[model samples]
Target: MEFGNDCKLIVGVDYGTTSTGVSYALTGSSQCNEVISIQKWPPNCPGLKVPSLVACAGSPGRSLWGFEVRPGMKSFAWTKLLLDPTFNCDSFKVEIREVAGALGILKLPEDRDAEEVVTEFLRHVHQHVCGELKRFLFDTMSPGRVPIEFWMTFPATWSEAVQSKLKRAASEAGFGDKVFTVSEPEAAALAVFRISKDFELNVGDGVLICDCGGGTVDVTSCFITDMNERGVPYFEQLTEETGSNCGGINVDCNLYRLLVTKLGEDFKNLSTTMVGPGSNFMKEFEYIKRDFNGELPYTLTLLGPVPREITLSPGDLRGIFDPVLDRILSLILSQIKRLMQSLERVLSTSKIIFVDGFAGSPYLQIQLKSALRQQMAEVGVLVAPTPERMVACGATVKGLQGIVAQHTNAVDIMA
Candidate 1:
């Protein structure tokens, strides 16, 4: 693969706990505005992201990943959480226990560690991304003809050790030596800042980023420092990121428990017979969870031996969601308090809260807006235009910024 000196390709990979997304831009073109997300994935997964799952249950030395890994297969899920050493802390005890139980029941091969599993999954992602690049750029130039720089995003709360491990995994997965890393919240912020036209951001104004994903929710606050002539906002971190295990998966778990309580003995059979990936029960519930906005009642039908209809009223949905929502709310408020302390003043009316990630639920957004309105009436809560792809897109923006900085530095040196 010969690199072309005149052109370069920048790729961003957002590897979340439940799914992953990819975005890329050709540096020879415009900056962040021209960034494109890779939406085509194998096995016909219809989304901007693919499942972060890998299965090698039956075939040795051959792994199936993403949409290729079908339900009912013994696949590795949520392996991204394994990279965090603090995942076992008291706050995440329930999540840790759940992961352990799933691993034990699935009986994944003992030979592979979490890093290796993640590497395998990422390898598949890299391959698919490369294939897409080739397909798209074939008419102009081979992707190999140009240098490729890869950027990956991780949870903001992750430690240096976890970041290093994730970087190593990405490198091993064929991202090459040019693998760069960015915090998820920062990346999401960049994405929102680049495309946000409605908000008026001035110097020193505070912006809070809430990234709610499948397995965790991370909150970060930053203060705008400068803006370029193009209206791109630049900000500096104002506080250490705070996060928790309360995410969309927890909602699913809550719903499962609710069903068990509601159905009693009937749940036992339903759980054993129909509860798994690709199952109708899981699919229907996922749709309900994604589209539910606090006013709708959802009816879930169970098939197989214990066929029955369970209607979840608005109140029941609220019961399942409020606990998780409350946790996220606490995280945001804590960050806000910290920001206020740092600034040594009350939060200004110009403050903006940007929310992204797959679990940035519609109901969650509504709750955030309502709650923040009551607490800080002038503060606004805005959701990213492409919540699921925000991190990946922001990563490309970061990469583009790096390229621009390098070019400027080279010119300065020559001058």
Candidate 2:
């Protein structure tokens, strides 16, 4: 009897709130080092941070998907928002066809199933990626090469049941039959270990990674060490943590709100508070907060029944955003407290490493550094890179791991 040789093609996808990134690794590559940018600015999609926003359109037989959604203050029902209690999914049905409820699909009919909405979204993303892979491979190989397998990643805390649902959605969307699942943290760890292999990490050395993305706060504490003294890194999970749906997106929301309120002060008798699509005032305020850079005399325009505009100085924006800033600060401090408590119980050390999108903000980074310095004086807290592309980059590393592991196994069996 003869068996087909094992083959490998790994794809690392980061399904973020605002955007989604997909990267692939060949069988023998040292790393999945390339960053694939799916969405860019101008005519921005509904998704903000990245391009995970799925716009459902086209005929009944076939549908279209992409970063084609119009920008501005339009409301978007992100799939991640489903986990938020503020959203009412009780009236919704989760149909398997689209991966989201019919009621929530951007422009679809109102009665669609939730599952259809989600599945359709996932299917589109998969198709887009496959197209990219085809183009990438065309340049590297002849047309007759066998297709590559994919390694789809999910959050570490996702239940197997939820994961099964995602896999089913992908399969239904025509993702090749050969696909696998992985956790986001594991991928992130792989990426960190790959870059810092020379750190001489030991069981006693704790590495804390914080993924401050658009919609969620994902934190992990790991005991990174060379399980085999030969320098191959192994990770031991320590206390992992998250926060109450806090992140850069939330900060944007707060900035938008403040800006709206500041503009309203110009109106008389008639109230000038924002009242559309959640807290309008808060959303505008959040945007202004994010845009504040000590620059003077910035103008903000409000679109509503009575359109209005207001000019603001750096001081004016800061004063209006103070409340929101305080809230975020408190939230960050709380998360740190939780991490410290968890560390005390899980390991004998307290060192923490912070990485993610928020790490890029000078204001946020400075505030965090100062707070951590004051609270966890003995514990080292450091943020790598300002933009916090670690998760996407790390996911790529994991994709490479998937490739290497397969090649190693095949070689062992052949010998």
Candidate 3:
């Protein structure tokens, strides 16, 4: 547990609409190939990430965030989307209305805006990450003494304005003077290529990455150019990255709509009886959605006034999932088509890599695999291991590369 004088720490934060993840690497002269994900989080949330949620009812300095914001608490979620100016447009009316309604019900402080909420949330995340780093590095070295670099991942299609807003928020949250940004799809590609042993890529091989997350689905095509002396692969973009707001949240919204339709008159009791942050119904539906695979019926028991049990049959789940799944598949297919046109040849050895939280859905994997098999029998689709942590881990890898390159250049200069 020793380090050289040139040792540095790299932290990567993946702040999603629904959750956030952190990964870091400690590097020196040798190549740092291993990125450690911060699995332990506040309030004992047992996962690689914590919900991107914040409760601002109390003082701003004492605001509760992540797992600390529990059910029934008046909290803010999806504030990340508000950073985008286009989020208010007709295309995002559904999501925009959802957020507006939640804010209205919560009656958040008039002075606190989306940027402020996001900054506060990230501040908590930064503090927790620092504590974890200090504990992990214990007596070996002081994190404060090392040159720590912070890298954050953003959607590939986010506008420059949105990116700037995110960077500003991160900086205010103590991510340092200069917070680096990595496109989500590129980060996913980096992690998948670095860690995945399921498939090997040769020079000139194409990889299409489909990142299905809580707020957005992004697709990117990368061509493997070469491998470095240390066995790290290099990639070149084959086509423009494509993405849309059609993601897992859309399915949740669909379920909400279905519940409202089914419950009819009784849906009005959800406010006083059910919990905030989209109600207990949505929370229960999340587990059902993740475990669903188009074969069994999932039953949800409502606890509000006039309690009732609702059964979601296979067909009902399909109806809720198909629209969003179709949109994601279209994105992947479009990327494939564009990649083929750019290469002007067949994609015989190419593979499709799925990453991000939504990629863990069994139904999504089954449908994507089935569709790809039908269209391109030779092409293979594989889910990146620990799909949820890919972006954050990949961001760490990118940071590690930067540190190594700088160390190598300094050595050459000294020589």
Candidate 4:
């Protein structure tokens, strides 16, 4: 926390496609990456993430965001992904449009576009975060505006159009001129460096970071050069960023489609219509998908369904997961290969770290490690302990490295 006296606080917001997470820390303190994460919202809900969803009974001002919306509420899912002006709907296996239609949430006035929905959602986030800061950090401050800097994260795979749209939405949502943007993988890497006890970067060391979110997976390989005077680590790009649309949502989509095919249209309509909290198929899949390692074979049983229980064997589950897993593997292998060919000398010490909630799956980490270690035995794979907060915290860390590091250097020079 070698921050400057000029700044009062630094905030990071990971506005993801599936879930949004926020993290903040005071600047100019000696608190080594000590961050406060916005896990629970009003009414005391559990979990460090909030669903990236928004619903309006009428006007955008009346929208309900995140955990505030009930399951039966007419809300939109994956609204952030929808913001991509160039998104190819045909390639996306899951039809978000159809899902919206099925849920009947797209009725007039409430039928808002991606940007509109996101703006409303972030507005709520801004309000909540500001209130929390006021209560905890600024309670004793004099009657004046507190100086705060904001960092928002986005995928490296996104085009400038997508990134600009995000920035615009944030601006509309009340983010001030102090706000800045960072790529998901970059933010995640700094975050890892901060939290990882064994993490150390030397002049020749290499590290690969894979940030797998709901809608996209971004991979970056960094070649560590040297630390700043203040002992802050810095990295140079080793390979071009690799990314894929294959993420946890695709797995969920495939599983859902498979279930629909097996259970028929009747069940499809019924479940999507009245999917109770954590009792539906996708919810059930989430609870177990991370644990399943294709070990001893697997079967996902549809829970809370009336009249009959539906069961899917390991073969079926694998069939659903194979395509998405293949895409992810391809990205990982591509980056590893690129780095190994280029940094053959330090390849032995290189490590791959997966951040973001989707990549937190033990099954995925095991599969990746098994596949990767076979090729490079000395390499290691570690999943971020708190996948949900890694991106947000990483964004915060990015600000620290850039702003605070520079300020500390200037201060030392003056002293």
Tens digit of lDDT per residue, candidate 3, span 147-193? Answer: 57888899987888899999899988887777888899988888988
- Report the number of the highest-TM-score candidate: 3
Q: Write the per-residue lDDT of candidate 4 for residues 1-415, one digit (tens) a residue.
A: 1334454567899998778899987655555346888877854677788877666667657878777776566666666776775564536634644444433332333356778778888988887777776664533333444466778998877788888888888878877644588899888888877754555455566788889898889998887677767555667777777787787877766665675678777655664435422234446577767667665454454434455555667688668777777788788888877877876474543788888998877767777788778877888777878787899998887776656422111111121
- By TM-score rank, best first, the candidates go 3, 1, 4, 2
Q: lDDT for model 3, on a 0 to 1 scale?
A: 0.78
lDDT of each: 0.74, 0.51, 0.78, 0.70
lDDT of 2 by residue, 1-415 (tens): 1212333445666665554556565443332344443333324343213444444454322544334433322223456444323334422222112322211222323545444655666676766666656665555444434335555656554657767766666666666554467666555566666555444456567676656565555566677645656565677775554433455555544443454365443322222234322234434544554445545556655555677666767666555434434554565565556656765455533455555555455555555666666865766666564234556556666655534433211111211
Model 4 scores a TM of 0.85
Which candidate order results from sorting by lDDT in descending order? 3, 1, 4, 2
Candidate 2 accuracy as lDDT = 0.51
The list of candidate 1 runs beyond 4 A from truth reads 1-6, 30-33, 57-61, 95-108, 140-144, 269-273, 344-349, 403-415
RMSD of each: 5.0, 8.1, 4.6, 5.5
Count of backbone clashes, every candidate in sequence: 0, 43, 0, 0
Pick by TM-score: 3 or 4, better one: 3
